[model samples]
Target chain A: MAALKDIIARDYGTPAVVIDLDIVTHNIARLQAACEARGLENRPHIKTHKSPELAAMQREAGAAGITCQKLGEAEIMADAGFDDILISYNLIGEEKIARLAALIPRARIIVAADNPVAVDAYAEAAKRAGKPLEVIIECDTGRKRAGVESVADAIALAERIKASPQLRFAGFMLYNPEDAVAQTQAFLDEALAGIRGLGLEASIISTGGTPNLSNLGRIRGTTEHRAGTYIFNDRMMLACGAAELADCALHVYTTVVSRAGPERGILDAGSKTLTSDIGGLDGHGLIREFPQARIARFAEEHGFLDLSASSRKPAIGDVVRVIPNHVCVVVNMVDRLIAVRGDEVVGEIPVAARGRIV
Target chain B: MAALKDIIARDYGTPAVVIDLDIVTHNIARLQAACEARGLENRPHIKTHKSPELAAMQREAGAAGITCQKLGEAEIMADAGFDDILISYNLIGEEKIARLAALIPRARIIVAADNPVAVDAYAEAAKRAGKPLEVIIECDTGRKRAGVESVADAIALAERIKASPQLRFAGFMLYNPEDAVAQTQAFLDEALAGIRGLGLEASIISTGGTPNLSNLGRIRGTTEHRAGTYIFNDRMMLACGAAELADCALHVYTTVVSRAGPERGILDAGSKTLTSDIGGLDGHGLIREFPQARIARFAEEHGFLDLSASSRKPAIGDVVRVIPNHVCVVVNMVDRLIAVRGDEVVGEIPVAARGRIV
Candidate 1:
């Protein structure tokens, strides 16, 4: 193994995603420790890295299985020998239902559904497979994306799952904004009371999101914490004060391809690599060496770096590391991530679930 | 071949990029005719489709050559039997220069450079390969992207390319906004005059951009027009009045995974598939079936569909078609695109040049 810089200089190409396994291991340990100290099970979401290798590290570090946002990702992880998978999305359509039923014999799959249309499909799939499927009711706290609106709807969905002979009502799950944590907690607590009133014991009250990682055990009824982006903290995490820049393990190594003028420079990496997911951030990403230079905009293959704010300028051919605004999207863009341990190139980790967006 | 509806019902998965070959062939012929009528060479930029098959279709439709935005794409096209390639980007860094030099023998490689740094790299790569590489001067032309600022700088860079024994100075290229066409034409005219004064022929004055496609031969002295998105018009194209909704050839077929409420629904495809590229549009994309429904926002695997505006709403298991705000980024996200003819499933076209960001 050579130094990371040496390996980058000798082997890696420009505009590549490089991951530091040393920091990854540390980040995993940190999150595991946080969950353990708070009496909560840590279910590391695989959407962040989309790598079975990284998910294995999290599981070995004492994670309670893994979480996937889609059935496609879950199928990939199950193929990679990851059991007890939780797909935090409604499995709709006959195709997905049939696929989910087929996946039952391979691993324990827990699904989330906010409506009966999804619940009926899950029931159909479960009955088709002749096996009981675990399901959780998704309650809308404040995310405004997908979830049942009221506690009554949550209880009704729970009853519907309970009524299905092939389905087991696990509990509730909610993904809310950081500001709506208190509201979400109250709704979950009330929903729990309603479910408990039906003589049903809620096994898992799952709450997730990387931004909500810090408030894991603080949410009273949350039995498990699911987080994804903490494995490789990005600029968004840094902006939210959740992680320091040193904790960012994944960085895009891009070369300055064009210094159009003194005020403007262009990097080889752009929306295709770094992504246009600003997420209300100031810029696309953070340049490690040139901290003051703002990534103003991006074309498909060109990242416009505003060099006017910085006294230090990068020359053409100079490779700079960038921590993307959202690391998950960046990981989804590439086929494989360059794995590095400290200052050495470890290996290439295939993003087996990179484009599994079924 | 089975009908597309039948194929999708029996085989295809949700959240897929579907390309109508009928429309693609029509688009190619239409653009080629437009260019030919204007006495301009149509050099189709492969960045939109990122498929060698589609690029070959352009070639068969009478395109002079193919235009790639990166050396990696050029290499892919060359490997796929494309003999003529114009990589409309600066080849920077030792590795890229070496790759470019090696590719010169495989195809007719034309490189674009805005500064001495890129010109010098092209010269070095050419000298190493012991073959003359064609080089073009990229003018800024009010796009504020990569290009020389003034006529003097353009002339200086052209002279530098001409001075290199291994480099051939081959006129100019500009990608300007639709509003900046007149300004860009003025600048290019002056630069062409200056180059002619230096006893240079300036044979290839290439101007490109899908938005500027209507001004194909209107710009005086421009010999070639490079348009990408016309082959698969997107929502942005529709909004910009470049193409009608019917002209959109590429669309994402996504299933409604959750009808969270009466006004809100969620699609399986999100930023990962459709992308978060708003590009000054009202929403992320245009829903073909539900024209009034807006794709409000996106999570990683969930597209938040605001259906308040539409009388008809999508239910769980219902799949809808979406024309993305930017088609190029969507094509880059997937490994393969489903090809169809009218209502029939033709085949799958592998996006061979996709993710070739370097």
Candidate 2:
């Protein structure tokens, strides 16, 4: 059998996805170690990678539970035997309520709610399932995406859930968008005080991100931290002061197929392998080991590389590894990822939760 | 027997991909008619939808041939009996070369080359197969992505292919990235003149994009024009003055899962459905009938929606149909699209050619 790179260049197929298992294992170990040092439980969200196999590895390396954003993701995780999973998003409707009821029998699924409607849905689902489901009042400490802005709103929702025999009041949950450790720590400190003063027993204070994972000292009040992309930090994380490029494990292996212009060369991997994530420190993610090459445009299966002045031009069959701006999005695009370590094919893991956008 | 939306919503399948097949078919027919009126042959590229079923529809509707960017996409088309398919991308490697050679026996396939190294690879593949392969020299008229810059380089490549008994020079191919119709027409005119001055028949002066299709008051001196996204013009094109929003047939079905804050509402569809195509008009794309909702941040499975202050708030359980910013990228993310016709379930088309990142 051919080794990893040789097979990847040939039978691994074109526009295929390859994951370095060793690198991924290293990332898992590193993150788990970091969370453990501060006596914080690591609940890595499945959203970043959305792989059940990867989640199993994280659990093996000592994760308290798994975090999921959607009910679909939670369903997938629960089916895969993940009993302690957190569906960290607002739940609604009869269809979703039914699915949540079905999930309660299989796992310890906790959901986040910031409003009465969501709390009502949880209550109805829990009552239907004949179980008291855990509910965490989500706070908009920062990152104005969702969650209650003030503590009063959070308390009101918590009280409503408390009124229901079907619900159990958990602690508050938040996502800090800031990347710097010091700033994230300071922000979390005041938010913790405010939540604690609510007179409700806020058990688990969850706060974690790939950017703020390393500087988690300031978040001493955090009972648990949630970080996912840290397992496979991409170029975006490297640029955002989250992690170094050396720590990034997942990379898109592409081939230079066209080099007819002075300023541009074309790669087989386009927006499919490398999705458009332009918010990274660099315009696009760093072109690993190819400082001269910059991704200018993405046309689905075609990536336009600006390498006009490079002395060395990649031939038609030359292989190039690209570290995407955001690793999470890249991993989300493929159907499966081949996990390899050197010449040996460690495993062929299906991106099982792929297309689980619901 | 229920409609697509009814079946999916009843199942509470969050974050669904919906396609108006009637609108798609209508769009295809309308665009083909326009191209035919302009005296141009339409070779629809498969990158937009990445569905062999859709490609077959285009071929059935009198498309001269199909255009694809990857070998995998071309192979899928070939399997679907699209014999006269053009792999409008650079063919590379022993594996790809071998695949290219094998495909020649099954379909009338033509591969593009922009460099001499690639020229040699094609020569070797054809020689190995003992089958003469057609070649198109990709010319970068103004896109700055691929293709030779000057006419001298074009002639030089033509000479190389003509010299090789295994290779046959078909013509020239250029993909201009100009947003205006007039600019692309002018660019094509100049490139055509340059190719003609060399005494070479530029049979396939292939240029395709949503913006360039309607801009053609008259056809350039090229035999065929290619376009993919014209079948379903995306938010980018709609914003770029290319196509109207009515021409857009693809959308994401999402529910207002959470309304935690006054300025923030969360939709089940996120970056995974929208595919993070920023810098377009309206920030992201038009949200079906709700023209007021702006996509704040796309979090994998959750689309952060912030409605216009003037528009009514989306209540929990209320569904929103979102027109994606980039349909091509969005198509690659899903496994199947519910093909509908006026709220009726027409068919369930499997996106067979998706995840072909190589």
Candidate 3:
């Protein structure tokens, strides 16, 4: 089989997600080393790559386990022989609960929940399945997206889990904080204090974000770090000083299909491939070959690149690699990642959990 | 099999794309009737639904053919027994050309190109396959995304196609214009004048956009209107006054997974499900039940719904139907669409060409 680099030069198609395996290996090693140096358990989130094969690479690099955002993703990872998994989303519905329960017997399944309804449902499902599920109380440190608003709510949920025979109070999980060390330490200190007051010991404390991965030691109470995007850094990571441009492992190989104007051109990849994730950036993504060119706009199947800033413009049929704004969402958009090592197609890693949105 | 409406009310999973077959049938009939009344052919673009079953429904509704944005999509449509297929994209590379060549024998494959390089490649591929490929000169009407800038350039490409033995000059293709009728008429008139001046005939003049579908008749010299989103009108269409909310056929069923605050809750659907296609709207999507609510932001798998404006807020696990800003990109995000009709799941339609980006 032609290496991915050769495939791109030869028979490879445009608008395809190509992963640099060498970079991925280096990324995994670097992040793992950082966590190890901090004495933090590195549970890399598989939601970034969504590939069990890549997860195995993380595991080989000394990751304690893996993290997933959904039960469907956890199921995919579990089926691929990953025994320890943490589903970081509050899973609801009987179908999802039943699926979660099914995974408890096969893997060391840990789930996060903030509300009583989800906690009750998870307890019931675990009881019905005759398996004790490890439950994590998700606390909202600053990011108002999900999790309990206060440490009291986190303690309350942890107490409820401690009181349940089917659910075990494992730890607390929080995401995306400006000051991870200070915010997470405060949240964990209060929650842990409350848990200790209730005669309970918290087994784990997790805080994760690629932007804060290197500063895990400063997060006083965090025992495990669950950073996902660090494994395949993107423009967002680069912007946040989490990773350099060279640390980005994935790139969408696209062909310039039409030069609409001297300063404008269209690529085969668009919203469907590169995605609409601005990631707090100005444009859609960065064109590696034409750094000055801006991916100004995207239709579903066409990426409009503004080449006016470039001294030399590319002609039609020229292939350009784009580093997406958010690599995780971009990874989930495609079916498989074409793994390449120095212009050689090393392997084809199927995105095992690409659209497992349940 | 139960109807989709019943499925949504009962066993359907949240964050799944549900298409009401009744609305789809009605939307298809309504648009087809409008095109028929104007004596224009309606070739609905399959890029929105990406399902053969839906395309068959379109064919049953008297569609002239189907429109695909990618050759991979055209190949899928061709395999499903659709003969007249127009791939409105610049076909490039030996791999893509070979695939396009393979589809030529199976379907009446018509492709668009704005540059001579693409036209020459298509002609060469057609010659190698011993099949005459229908070539369309794409003109940039107003959407500065793709297509030749001027009528002279369009005629020049048309002339090249007319002179080629392997390539057939079929028509002119353009996409999304602010003033579709006036702009398309002017472009078509000039291109037609230029083609006639060169002693040639412009067989087909195709223009399409859901926003301008109603004004197809006013665009003189165009034989077919290729509106895709009319079959599943979205918030963009609703805003454009092209179609009412009643005409919308697709809805994403999502569950409230977290109630972060009194006026804020997170839905299970986010960028991965609903997509980041704001369609020039303020938010990500429109929640049908909570029209006053704003889909403020999106994480990869979580949609933050602002319930501050809504009189009533939903609790966790409550399913709400969200009509995406752009349905085409949302359709591409999922693996399957739950087909429902009047509260019953009629069937599960696989998104056959979901990730056929090549």
Candidate 4:
């Protein structure tokens, strides 16, 4: 593989998301192998890449299926002939339900619902479509974002889904707990037993996050793992000890547009490209070569690069690659990714599911 | 105009950017009136509202021209029949220069540059196009983002632009200084005198920001103002006392997807919709009806609403409006704006210049 600078010089304009296909293939295989070793299904989340081509690669790489966060993304993937999908979000409102109804017959999609309102809506959409929509109860194992609060609540929701004619109670879903893994495991264990006692099969125990990839086998009942950021591991993943810097595949290729002050260099990418998602990292992104240079601030289009600590300052028009704080948001901001193989410009992969926020 | 709730009920799905066109028109006229009363040319920055239609409306309301932060945005506006454009940021690299060369023949474009490197590139592009491109020297008048550090540097840059046969030296450009207006005025006053002493006509003295709109006519030798956020006043503008809550024209219409606990509610919109730009505000956005509910945190597709303080809690599937922290970024996140006039949805306007980072 040629140096990144060579690839950048030969192929890119400024502020492009450059993806190394070699690294991407390696990342997919690594995660897949890890999941397979743990006797777990690798249902790679499509939120990070938002590319049908990339999702296709994951499906081809001994993965169980794909996971999407939104109905719009799932629709795009379904359009591209993805059969099995898990929309890991509450499908709310009448408009979404109508869309879900239309989508039910096209492919196998399992949606996770935490509240009874969402479960009822999914059931309505399923009834309308005349096809049973598989649903998993989102248990609040530890992540207090969205889920059933207790084991009893999880069982109640599972029973509710089982009562509905157009719904199938799949199992339980939880975003992999970071530090409270044991507590979360206990909650899931009790919930699973409770669910099984209700004469329902808890086939899919989906628990995942890129940061908790190391605990794949350690988790008691995690039948499938859903990880998004592992495809293009970023500074956040590196900080969490999930992946190394070399493992990151996606990089924001930007040009130093200004050196207004002796120590301050401004790049063409800012919140619009790199995003303001710091993800508890030091700076907006990590400058690959100029490691000491901090991306101090951002205008809509200008990235303020603080080169005070760095010995290597990027001169005006000098192209540099930045590994962003959160790769998922970075990918969401762009329409396409500049695909590269070493120094060669391989192709352009359209982010077909980009800005599918609904 | 009809109530916002009626509009949401009739016309919106969750996670939509609903623009009140009447309010947008009123906001445009208000800014234009303020600029006109002060004898300043109103060149509304298109970075906030990337729609060519809104740009057209601004032009109709007596704006001198449109200001764009990127070359890609300028191209989009030019394609939509905008002939006079002021690209506020420095256009860097060979690819940008080549595009600028192509753009010169089609439009009356004025570009700002703070350094010799950028000035040289503009001259090269002008030379390639066989046209004299009007260039302005950006002076660091306290806003310290991108500009020449001193009056002497500004004069030197102006001279460099003047020396090039293909370039015409237009005046100076400065982002409106907030509290340091007196010092910035002194710098600009000296720079203006210095440029005039060199037998160069400083025709355009551009200084602007929505926050500094109150200081419009107070600043000496200011010919034009560039403000973007006023078109769709956000919580940032409201916090700065630049706008009233009623003055806010654009809002994110979202649905309450979950009520995990009695005090906790989660909306379908998150960082992807509302964005992570807090702009030093309290929360991610202001819930219109439930002012006490804080947008505490965000997952990729879920907005955690802290409803502990709010008396009015949104029920599941209930659509609500959100005024984002920074409106400019919120506009950039979506593809189209749901244009409304009270209860009636006028049309869907495509954000033609969205994600034009380069």
Candidate 5:
């Protein structure tokens, strides 16, 4: 039986996530340098690669800590000796709270809470654990996914965190502001002012998104930035003008299994490997070898590539590399990623937190 | 240090794939009974559950064999003692061909080929293995995803398979016909006539799709039926009138992480857990508790639920069971599925072929 490692070593199969380590290193250095030049702490989100090795590389490149979307991810990073971790998602449920409390002693764990109910739950769990858990109040700066709506609401949540004996108020964390610099800065300034007016100190102000990473310096009050996809720029990032095609470090290696017609072919990579996130792009992913070919549709294990527009169409049994529309979700879909450097296989990194949805 | 097992055991986490065993049994029995009544061979596609235990149940319930989409899945099922297996996708590339050829000795393995290139590859591998491989020519019956274009094309491919030194032409396999019954029957009849006219024996005519299972009897030439999603019907199946809400065996157990606003809430389940396959449906999925609520949008780890249509809204920390837009992909996303019977935790089934995209 050929394991994933053997298959990757021999370049034996398709539908595998391949990461170029050199490109990854360059991407990390570029982002870290950008943040350092602006005097901002770069706490890169580990949700993209989810590898301890990659997270360690980021930390070595001067990242303050790591950011995770779930406690499961944070636990994996914490186990890997990442001392400072920020879970940017709303921490709800007793089970999750207990898990968060357990991580308090092992690492400098910080969690986000958008409401007082979440704040109270965190306080209760921390009190039970006999430890003080750092709480970051999530604020809505136009991204309506999660977070307190207004400055007053953010101040109220911050105050509740400050009032709790077991919870330490650790400033704010917003997902990704719609309007980058001015509006995000205004919202942060107002919320900070409101919190200070309540006689509490707001320390850390964190914001993230690869598209807005360049504008992090423009946002005046943010102390740290958390961008996951910057490590492995994708088609979405390229389309958003965040990175060029040359900056994409990870690519899905796939084989054209069937050429149904002159205009259409099917690749082994599908929604399972490449993901269905178009990210407002025209197609599912970008074929590096065949730039004009569009990933028209996807079955569970079949990516339908439209080769009508391409001057050079690949035959059945030919291999191609696809850059996914969204790299983070694609990373979450696979178990391991093969890391390469200029055609030579360096090593393989297990996506430690691949399916850590909890 | 809570593992997935511990989390599932305590029912402590959200965004878990919960399988109702009773419903699974019923679904298996119902589909088998239908096929039995119509004298059609039930080769249930194992791509849905991908569990050896469930496959055994299906086989015991009178499934003639099992169907898989990848060589990896075939190897797993073959290891689990399933002797008769049909891999529906075209087997290309040396590695996959070698794997398929290896399965030939262990199981009565059959593979599909839409073109001569794949047929030649299969023949080469089977010849190298010194085994006669059963080869089925995939026919295009309207779904242009795979298979040969016309009846003549399918017959040509079948002739190519018959002429191979180590291949046995096993007849045709058509993807779910867009227009069932009349079109399917016509397509099958024409393809059969063409192959017979070439003095080749066309033994097995296999056709499959969950939507066309009820009309399988109407397609006169089809000897076998392959359906995957009928085991755990999804929202797409319900919308296509394939199954009812009560028939859906699987549900995504998710927690309301944040009530973003009065009319909006976020669930822990997102594209990572539930998939972005809307399948021509309106929303991402259907929340069983709040039938009127629409899963409006999804970030990688967050599902935005629009509660504006619902009279009752769930608060943060509340659990909601969601029937995903597509269950097959959802099953492929998770590592293990928690099986339950009337609120009692029966057991857990590891998704043996979860990431078997290769």
Candidate 6:
């Protein structure tokens, strides 16, 4: 076991992030095919991988466009030549709106605003831009994160957008968290009816979360969907019964740095890499192929793994792979990632939007 | 209240990581002063705020040196001309050891190895580098993270280090997560006594954790103490009664992007910015001045806040200040930070070690 560990270690090494590009491409195709099969557009949210390279792959896979949550993220995508992008999340403020206005001239930009105040803010910005800004009325679909309460609320917001010369109503967007497939579709159907019944065009009904995507075809009236974390399914997805462990593509490659006791050892990666996001899971993350090894604690630089529950006693210098609870948070932490295939270092991807936290 | 929020927003805007440099400098001085007053050397861990500029500031504030958990972080410090540094975590594998060996000649390199396997690995690297590597035995001081368990264990490890020509025994490094001050000294003292009882030199007694800093003065015969989160006191520190809100220097500047229901609104800064580090805390982060606004949910790019409890509604474009549960994680998420002084942008500091997760 030690020799095997060393061999694998020498091949991939420690303190590296390994991504199975094959799995990523597979996920892209599966997601795109699922959405297109449902007669909906698949606007791959670049926010997940935040890689123009990956976004291009999604575009090549028949994606209608890309979705961005931040203007910063959108700016990066636009710069990467992904012109048709949807700012899925809410956009606010003069600084952000000004950026949005500038982006509109170059890219086909659409955004969401859930309230009259935000609608007015966008209208004023659009008036300054001297063009109707594309707007999506957000609908609350049980997640309670954002969006208006019902179709009436959404229509009221859309009507406000329609009244404003600075803004044009485009569609609706809702993100449900770890939602069951049936529940998400039901909520979307209910919300969309109210919007479409208003005699206004709610052409775009966007809804996507990995858990809900398994039955995306069953959902009625959703013309497009946005799901990000599906590119690299994490422990949370596995825990939620959304993805299989074998489907996970990203892992924090950590070396056993310490054997504090027979029961305890420290891994090179910590909250800085695995992240402090439990994502409602039992522990920080799932130690790939080392289920019994519990993540007992996390310092900024080292993760303490209690391996007594497991039958194996891992020696120091052994490389362990950790599938983080939330893949997206882990992605934002690194400067670059080592792309590997079966212990071979083939290439490196500069985490282009690694720290576009703004 | 709206005026105050607007003042804060206009004065301190969104997508910005606000660190009152003045407060930071004071906090550094305060910690140094405390450590000095306790007759202990302060080796502030560079992990909390991975900025070499801040490390230099800490050194200038009377820190004996800086402690880094990663070799990459150590390299960043060395690049900043910081010589006397401690790579507090373990050095593993030939490649990492080779990197460590290369760094040893450039800086006063001190590393820890808790197991025989890792110790020998470092020893071989040190021998190859022709530089004496100071090795500290990490003791599992109630944290259960890393370190030797008993006096016998400590003595055995110290003897092993003494036997290796490349590895020099340099006291002990105990990461006391549970109770750094209370339990650390007794356990460390016993271990050191047992090591000295074995006729081996037990010199430096280092222990740390931001939470235990207040009781640090109680620990006797402790030569040096290391702490990182003390500089940028987080919500966790505040929750643990370790630091005050005023002591917290890092805050994420965000804006209210969408208001759905009466009480619900979405914040621009989410998991990607503030991170999903609940860390035994109730919410994602503290709303700094707005204690009533509860961050109920956090997406990768949006934080859902329930603002119904507040006296007034946080309109779109209005900025809100959030003190993250873990400031360290948030700092690692961004590349460059805009330092401001009352709406005036003072300067932009590159997060020198921003993505050194590896």
| Pairs clashing within candidate 1 | A4-A343, B4-B343
TM-score of chain A of 5: 0.96
lDDT comparison, 4 vs 6, better candidate: 4
Please state the error at residue A180 of candidate 5 in Å. Answer: 4.2
Backbone atom clashes (below 3 Å) for every candidate: 2, 6, 15, 0, 0, 4
lDDT of 3 by residue, A36-98 (tens): 888889999888999999999999989999999988898889889999998898888777776
Q: Give candidate 2 misplaced runs (Cα > 4 Å).
A: A1-7, A13-16, A179-200, A308-316, A342-345, B1-8, B177-203, B217-219, B279-282
lDDT per residue as tens, model 5, A330-358: 88887888888865788788999888888
For model 1, what is the error of residue B317's alpha carbon versus the real structure, in angstroms, after optimal superposition? 2.3
Encode model 5's per-residue lDDT on B148-219: one tens digit a residue: 877778878888887888999898887756475677678788888888887887678888889987677677
Scored by Cα lDDT, where does model 6 land?
0.77
What's the C-alpha lDDT at position A350 in model 5?
91
Task: For residue A27, give model 6's deviation from the true position in Å.
Answer: 2.0
Can you tell me which runs of candidate 3 are displaced by over 4 Å? A1-6, B1-10
Clashing pairs in 2: A14-B358, A15-B357, A15-B358, A358-B14, B208-B226, B269-B303
- The residue-by-residue lDDT of candidate 1 on B141-163, one tens digit each, is 77777888899999998889878
TM-score of 2: 0.92
Give per-residue CA lDDT, model 6, range A1-358, as digits (tens).
3453454456545767778787888888898888876788998777767788878888999999888877778888888888788886666666656666777777787888888877876787677777777898776767777777776677678778878877778877767554444666665666556556656677677876777776575556678888888988998888877789768988877888777677777788887777777777677777765789998778777788888898977777668778888888787777666665544555777668776655
lDDT score at residue B317, model 5, on the 0-100 scale? 77
* Model 2, position A109: C-alpha lDDT score: 85
lDDT of 3 by residue, B54-123 (tens): 9999999899999999988998898899999988889888788787777788978888899998999899
TM of chain B, each: 0.97, 0.92, 0.96, 0.97, 0.96, 0.93
Fnat values, candidates in order: 0.67, 0.78, 0.76, 0.62, 0.65, 0.73
Give per-residue CA lDDT, model 2, range B79-134, as digits (tens).
88888888887777778878877888888878888878778888988887888988
Please write out the lDDT profile of model 4 over residues B1-358, one tens digit for every residue. 3265555544456788889988999999999999999899998999999999999999999999989999999999999999889998887777788899999999999999988889999999999999999998887766667898888899899889878999999898888568878888888888878878889988898887899887886778889999999999999999999999889998888888888888998988998988888788888999887899999988888899999999878898788889999989889998998898877778899999898887
Off by more than 4 A, model 6: A1-13, A176-199, B1-13, B177-183, B197-199, B308-313, B341-344
For model 1, the stretches where C-alpha displacement exceeds 4 angstroms are A1-10, B1-10
TM-score of chain A of each: 0.97, 0.92, 0.96, 0.97, 0.96, 0.92
Measured with C-alpha atoms, the lDDT of residue A211 in candidate 3 is 84
